[model samples]
Every structure is written in C-alpha cells, then in structure tokens.
Target: MEANYVSKTAKSMQLHRRAKQVLPAGVSYFIRYFKPYPFYVDWAKGSKIRDVDGNVYTDYWMGHYTHILGHSPSRIVKAVKEQIEHGTHYGVCHELEIALAEQVVKMVPSAEMVRFSNSGTEAAMYATRLARSYTGKNKIVKFEGGWHGGYDALHLAVKPPFELLESNGITDGALRDTIVAPFNNLQETKKRINDKEIAAVIVEPVIGAGGCIPAEKEFLKGLRELCHEKDAVLIFDEIITGFRLAPGGGQQYYGVIPDITILGKILGGGFPIGGVTGRRDIMERMDPLLYERPKFSFQGGTFTANPATLTAGLEMLRNLEDGRVINNLNRHGRRVYRGLEAVFERKKVDAVVNCVGSLFQVHFTREKVRDVNAAYRADKEKLAKYHSALMDNSVFFLPAKNGAISSAHSEEDLEKLILETERFVGESGY
Candidate 1:
C-alpha cells in the first residue's frame, strides 16, 4: 500500500496527482476511478491489461463496453497503420467514411442514412436533436437510469437515487418537460407519454449502465406501438448494444425496430467513434443546408471521420464475418452468467446475475433487478468488496460490478474468473 490518493504504480501516481491539480476530479470521466486513487495502465492485449508496475490481469471491463473484437487486434492495428501513413484526418471526405457508413447501413435494417461523430455521447446528443427537429416537439421521455450523455436535457432523471425520482434534477421547465419512468414498466412509460409534447423516448434495449437489463419482448413491442400511436420517435441508444449484440444491433436481436438508433462502442474498433443511423427523411433534416441559418442541429468534430479510426472500424467489422465472433460471444457470455449464478446459489449469497448478449452484472441482492430502483437494492458495500477481490486476483472487471466479454475471452479465462468468484462468495458468505 502506497498512500490512499496514490496509484499503485508510483510514476503514474505522481502523474495522477498532477492531473488532479489541472483536471477536475483527477480524471476526465467519473467512471474511470480506481478510487481512493487509480491504476495506470501501460498496455493491454487480447483479454489482459498491464499496469505501469508490471501488474497484469485478465480484463473484462473491455473499455466500458467498447472493445467487442479485442484490444490491439492485428487487423485493426494494420488498417490503422495504413491509414496513418496515408495521413490521419483530411477534415474532408474520404473513402473510409463511405466504407464505414455503407457497412452500417448494409447491416442495420433501420438505417437508411448515417452520420459519424466522436463518441457514444455524441451519438446520443444528435439522435435527440433529430427526433425533436423532425417531429417539431418540445418534450422528451427517457427511462429512469437510461443515460444518453451529458446534454442537460437527457442528463435529467438518469442515475437518480431510487428515493429521489420525483426530486431528481432541478425543478425547472427543462427537467419538467423531460419525463422519467422505471425501466421495464410499460404502464408507467405510457403515463409519461400522455404528455402530447413528448418528442422521443430514448432507451437502451439492453441497458449498459443499469445492470445490463434487457427490455422484455412484450415491453419493447408495446413501446414501439406507443411511439407509432403517439407520433413520437423511439430512439435506441445502441452505443453499448450495437455491434456487441449483433451486426444489426439490438433491433435485430430483439426484433423490435426503433425510429432512430444511436451507435458507438464496438463500431469504432477501439477508436473514438459514434453514429446516428435512421430513416433518410428524418435524418436529412440534420442537413445544415436545409435550414435558413443552416442550423438544424449544429455538430462537428475534428476527428469525425478520421481515416485511422474508420479504417480500424472497417477491419473490426470484417472480423464478424460468418457470425463467428457473436456466436462465440453469446455462448461464453451465457456460461459466465450461469456459472456466477450457480456460485451465488451454493454460497447462499442473496445475489442475482443479470445478462444480455456479452454483458453481465453481479448484483449483490436478492431483489429481482427489473429497473433502476430494483438494482439499487444491491449491496454497494458488498459489490465494492467483490470488485476489490476480483482485482486483487488479477481478474479485472468493472470496479463497480459491471462486466463484458469479448471474442478474446476464452473458456479457460472465463472459468478462471468463476473459480476466483467462488472464493469471493464462499469467504464473504454472501
């Protein structure tokens, strides 16, 4: 043990403390904490990540659900190398953009048009704009715990404490117009839509931040019906669920299509990227030239269509050929979820494992975690203990209990995780 506010790796510890002085909260995103400090990664390959001090672990965080293919994949690296030599960002049109967009449109059934951006955050940002701009509505409906990004409108009602649902966010026109309801509660969802001004209802088909909860088949169908009847757009925030579920995203996996879909994560092949894929007419409204001041929704990025990232993304999608990666991913993901469930049973742990595709969460509570409220029943203290134990054992999962598997996670890797997890259950008598 080094100091509480210091990273285990001394050089990075110094770097992080300095970062704290210059950067708010010591890092960019609130989620990247090692908290009481951090761990500084020097490199990662395949399923393993290594820190600056030679500590290594089989990682399942998978870069917050981005690297479905793997880290430093040979094809992506090679493509990036080629693209870099050709020059990184032309800030103008290029073939890689066409290639990436074509692949998305070809694969996603709902996508007739595509626009690139820099992150899942950006994808969510523009999706709402399109929904509002095309529909000419002022209000929005979002599931409680459904997070799109930092934009103030969608930011409301996200990750609210269970007790504070009505009280979450500032009591103002922006927050008031935005409705919040529990996840998987269709009736409550409808109640919110009663507001005629609601423009879109954005949801994650398989929630990333909310315990990887998948929408029930009936629930999603009902949502689609509600959207159609109300003339409101339904947007799927597939940033976490897009390529990870299947090439066509959660829509194809669940067989419920939305009016608009925001995509990111695995699409970028480990590079920073995002996209809005939707109906041509709705998306065309985003064309600046169509508006008087050319301002339907102002959005641009210096690295919007950078060749290196797109080339890597193009190659990354290539690895999904013949359904090799997804088939294996689901098989492995189910195994991990079930194995953990069995462990909880044997250890008499009052816990449940929730999963969708390659994502899973170990909720340390007996409650059926259907919504953000249900997930809140999980024992945070116990989860922290489990996270620490896993990390100490060279098994790197999300420090907050969320986990994902990649094409690189082997049976050997998974069972190793299970065995370590068993010890956690047995010792804690959870």
Candidate 2:
C-alpha cells in the first residue's frame, strides 16, 4: 500500500518540492500541510477529488467545510457562470446583496440586519468592534479553545497551554483586553468575566478548528444569561455551524439566540464570504446615513457585496430552503458517527468520536472530550497514525480536524469510509 501511494503520487511529490520554493510549507493554508506532503489536487466534483497523479479519493475535507453542497454543485456553478458573464465585480450596490441579506434575515433568528465581508476573520474583527461601540466597553471574553479568526484581538487561547499567546507578533496590548474562559465550565467562565468591562463574549457553538467538542446546552444558556446581566454582547461565531446544523445555524439548534452572529464557510456557496448579522439597531451602527454620529462603527470592504459571491450565496440559500439537503447530510453524519463507535468497540480501541450535526472527529481517548483541555488529553501519536492510515486507503480527512459530511455524499461513500476505518483500526494495533 505504501509503495503504491508513493509510486502513484510521484508527480504530487515533485509539485510539493517545487511549491516549497514559493509557498510557505508547500501549502497555502497552514492546516493543509502534513508529514509526508499534502496531495496536489487536479480536480474535484461532487464528493470525490482527484490528485495530480490521477489518484481519486472520497473527500471529506470538502473545501475546508465550505462546500456544503459539495465541490462545484451544478446550481452554484450555473449561478456563478451567469453572474460572471454579467460582471464579476460591480463595486456598487446590486440587487443580489439584498437578495442574500434578506434570505439570512429570514433564516437566522437574530439576523434582523446583515453585513457581508470577504472572510470569517474580517467579519469577526468587525463584530468585536461593533460590540465595543454598542456597549461602550473595552474588554472581550472568549472561550479557551474558541477560534474566531486570525485577528489579533480574538486570536489568543485557541489551543492549550492557555497562558501563552497562540501566535507571535501579537502585541502585549492586544492580549491585555482579551479574556479567556474555560469552555463548558460556568463557574470558571463567570469568574473570568467578573469585574471585567466586557463588550462581547464570542463563542463557537461547536469548537470547529480547535476540535469537534460541542458546547453544552446549559453552558451556552448560562453565557447568554451572563451577557445580559453584564450588558455584554453575545457573539456566536457560527462560521462552521451556520447553515450546516440547520437553516438558522447554532442559535436555532441550541435555542439560545445571541446578540451578534458571525457566519461564513457554507454560507458563500463554495466561495470566500463572511457575514455579521444581528439586531437592527445594533447593525445600524454601520449605516452610512449615520456617518455624522460619533457612535457609528465604520464597516466596509473593497468586495463587501460583490455580485458574484452574493449571487452564488443566494442560489445556495434558495436550494437550502426546503431543508431536505441538510437533513440528508446530517443523517449520513449520524451513520458515520455510529459506524465509528462500532469500529472502536469491535477493535477494542479506547477512543471517543465527538460528533455534532454533520461534523465529527476521532479523538484517541476514553475520557469525554468536553473542552480543549480534555481534547488535548487524547493520544496524539495514535490519532496521527490513524489519519495517515485512512489517507493511504484512498479516503481523505484532514488530520486533527473535523470531518464534514455533504449532501453529495452517497451511501457507498459512507460504507467505504467505515470499511477503511475498520481496516485502519485492525492494522494499526490500537
């Protein structure tokens, strides 16, 4: 198996070597890099991807969970094609922006008003700023492993060893105002927020990049109550959870509506997009008509409402209105979750698979993974080996990242993944 992978992927290996000279770590995204090297994709369609070496695999990464409808779904492709023919960038107001925004407002419970940005990172940064402007507060409270974006203010404590900065070049001042709290621990979180002038408390309903550990229902409810008491804005960073869990995202699933919600990933119909949505009064702070107002929070981008992205997003949302697609994908995800549990039980492997909606992760531990600290306690080396083994068997899932199921996935795809997982466990001596 190893020899075949190496022989078939010779071209990909050559490309990786060439890419090293130009791209950092031979990959554009840091997470895309792995031990041997990341596969160079030639093309992808539906639920499968083909590498440069003509090696095809069932893809679960699904464009970093952005391709909820799967790679180049016919509807999105047609919409983008028609939109580009008209014009790629208008740099002015277009009807498509209103179309998408209206759809968001109708779907998401708290999205009375909407603002679009280019990426989740940008949207999150703006959400934080808006919170500060609304409450006249300076500090922000975020969960220990909650990953909002790459921005300086909300970038700390995404992973363990919470005392240190997650990345270098972050100034001391940037860290001063950001408070990190223990996820799923109400007492600890309340203590951290006590006496602090918190403008916003941003949290992921399910920790996406950190791990697939879900926030407990009681915990989320407690945070909502705390925010109301403290006069702080509750920001739900639903970049991964939005539209995937349900049409209304995590707030709908948990029945806890936040003051602000940051949405991205699946919302763009396989394009780069992010959105900040909330109450009308709060979002109106960015209204250009309020330019003379001292409380106005400036929010604009070069491609804020580009017609192409909005058109694609609108089409995607239109297709999702029936809710059948999301239901099917989630059903498959539950099947995968059960299959994983069965595999561990059969193989007598001490592992836990955390699953929520259409997302799942394999953690090599017997302990329940409720937070980042518990997730980190898993056997890292064994988990890495399991990921590698799955890849060798022509199944693609990002190492240490959650796997997303799409509506494009078929029963055969699920069966193959289960079989491959069984093989991996049996052969890995776990």
Maximum-lDDT candidate? 2
Screening candidate 2 with a backbone cut-off below 3 angstroms (N, C-alpha, C), the clashing residue pairs are none
lDDT tens digits by residue: candidate 2, 295-324:
789888999888888888998888777688
Candidates in order have lDDT scores of 0.81, 0.89
Per-candidate TM-scores read 0.94, 0.98
Supply candidate 1's per-residue lDDT for 232.
Answer: 89
Q: Which ten residues in a row have the lowest lDDT in candidate 1?
A: 1-10
Single out the weakest 10-residue window by summed lDDT for candidate 2.
1-10
> Against the true structure, candidate 2 has what lDDT?
0.89
Best by TM-score: 2
Superposed by TM-score, candidate 2 places the C-alpha of residue 207 at a distance from the truth, in angstroms, of: 0.5
